[model samples]
Target: MQFTSTPRGARLARRLVSHRLDEWGHPYDSAPNETLTLIAAELAANAIRHGHVCGRDFHVRLIECTSKATTVLRIEVADTRTERFPSLETPTPPTVDDESGRGLFLVSQLADRWCVAPRVGAPGKSVWAELELNHG
Candidate 1:
């Protein structure tokens, strides 16, 4: 899905992701569903705030893979600013009083694995996170 690089766009991205997760057998209130949605929201917001290029939009892709052992949900958000890559290596937690700067930190805590990569053949970067489903 493609969205304009704005607050409204970020919100729409999160909502759509929630709906998709629900359709994919993960209920809206499920732990994995909620966590992934929040992760999507943070990445989308970062794309808008840091990766936004005038008249350019960001993209979100959701993929699910299931195996005998586990099911994994992958979320990718791609934006048009190649120079402003997400710092997955050293995402230090923000101070308690700081309202911002905590998005990536929360993602690292919630996602089983997450990273930033160059958007294949695109000028920007894609930030991706994966969550392994609980079989119980």
Candidate 2:
């Protein structure tokens, strides 16, 4: 999915992710749906706020994978800015008085695995998160 680089777009991306997950057998209220939706919201917001390029929009991709051992859902958000990639090292803790800057921290906490990489065939980068689903 591609969206305009705006707050509304970020919001819509989040909602659509939840809806898509629900359609994929993860109900709206399921842990996987809610968790992946939140991850999408944060990444989309970051792309809009930090990765915004004048006329370019952001792109999001969701993939579900199942194996004998576990099921995983991967969410990727790509933007047209390559110079401002997030730190691959441990995210620095924001000061107590800071009003923001916790998006990636939250992602690191919620996602079983997460990374930022060069956007394939594009002049930008992508941040992706994956969570292992519990079958119970």
Candidate 3:
């Protein structure tokens, strides 16, 4: 889904992610649901604050894959700014007093795997995270 580059849009993206996960059988309070929702929130907020371009919007895509042993949910947030890709290496630890710069750090901690890549057929980049859930 595409969203305006604003806080409200970021918020909506998060809500929709949670709702969609619920539809996919992860309840609102389930670990997969809450974790992915928070990932969406951070990524969407980062897209708005760091990736925004005038008159341009951001996009979010969620994909679920199920196997006999596990389920994987991949969240992708693509934005129109190409110059500000997050570091592929470990994110530097933010200072205690720093109020920002921890979004990707949190993502790294929560997601089983995450990365930044060039958006396919697009001018910007996509930051994506994947969480694996065991069928229980």
- Could you say which candidate leads in TM-score? 3
Q: Candidate 1's residue-wise lDDT over 1-136, tens digit each? A: 9999999999999999999999999999998889999999999999999999998999999999998889999999999898988765858979989979988998899999999999998899999999997666
lDDT tens readout by residue for model 2, 6-101: 999999999989999999899999889989999999999999999999999999999999987789999999999989999998777788998999
How does candidate 3 score on lDDT? Answer: 0.96
List the candidates' TM-scores in order.
Answer: 0.96, 0.95, 0.97
For model 3, the stretches where C-alpha displacement exceeds 4 angstroms are: none
Question: Between the candidate structures 2 and 3, which one is better when assessed by lDDT?
Answer: 3
What's model 2's overall lDDT?
0.94
RMSD of each: 1.1, 1.1, 0.9
Candidate 3 residue-pair clash tally: 0
Top-lDDT structure, candidate number: 3
Q: lDDT score of model 1?
A: 0.93
Model 2 misplacement above 4 A: 134-136
Where's the lowest-lDDT run of ten residues in candidate 2? 89-98
Where model 1 places Cα greater than 4 Å from the true spot, the runs are none
Report the lDDT of model 2 for residue 97: 95
TM match of model 1 to true structure: 0.96
lDDT ranking from best candidate downward? 3, 2, 1
On TM-score, the stronger of 1 and 3 is 3
